[model samples]
Target: MRQWLFALGGLLVWTAHFFAVYIAASLFPGEPLASWLTLGLTLVALVVVGWLGLGAWRVWEARGEDELRPWLGGIALMGAALSAIAILYAGLTAVFF
Candidate 1:
């Protein structure tokens, strides 16, 4: 449902970005186009993850007495952080190697 999607959005975006970068690298090989595409994807992914993290932050702050909501928000926030790290690593590798 919507809740589940929100919780997993970071991981989903990370996965998609990873695959897209991989595909671009494969398609372009050593071409500069591949590096450019990876850079663009990395920037997009960072922005999206940041937005998702902000949403999760709001959810976490507004959890109040809802224990489940807080946990969901924390998980989402952590996932977003992890996804951002992954995206950065993949982007750098694709661009440099």
Candidate 2:
């Protein structure tokens, strides 16, 4: 159901994001294109996270902040934010190194 996904979509995106960056790093080491592609991917992933987070927040609002699952919505928002930060960190680190 939409409710269930909104509560956990972020973490799923984060998992895919983690693999994409790491795989790009390992599979295309020393390639300039790969580095740029990774950066591009990071940005795209961030946008997706933001969109999903906003959607989740909207869903939470619509649900009246379910007393029994308030944490579910909050966690989704937090996870999206944390994952975005992680993506930025990875991209910056790669750029610098």
Cand. 1 Cα-lDDT? 0.93
> What tens digits encode model 1's per-residue C-alpha lDDT throughout 1-97?
8889889999999999999999999999899999999999999999999999999998888857778998899889999999999999999888888
**Candidate 1: where are CA atoms >4 Å away?**
none
Best by lDDT: 1
**Which ten contiguous residues of candidate 1 have the minimum total lDDT?**
58-67
Q: Model 2, range 1-97, lDDT digits (tens) per residue?
A: 8767776677777788778878888888888876887788878888999998886576556655467455666777887778778778877677557
Compute the lDDT for candidate 2: 0.76
- Once superposed on the true structure, which residue ranges of model 2 sit more than 4 Å away at CA? 63-66
How many clashing pairs in candidate 1? Answer: 0
Cα error, residue 76 of model 2, in Å, equals: 1.2
Tell me, by TM-score, which candidate is best.
1
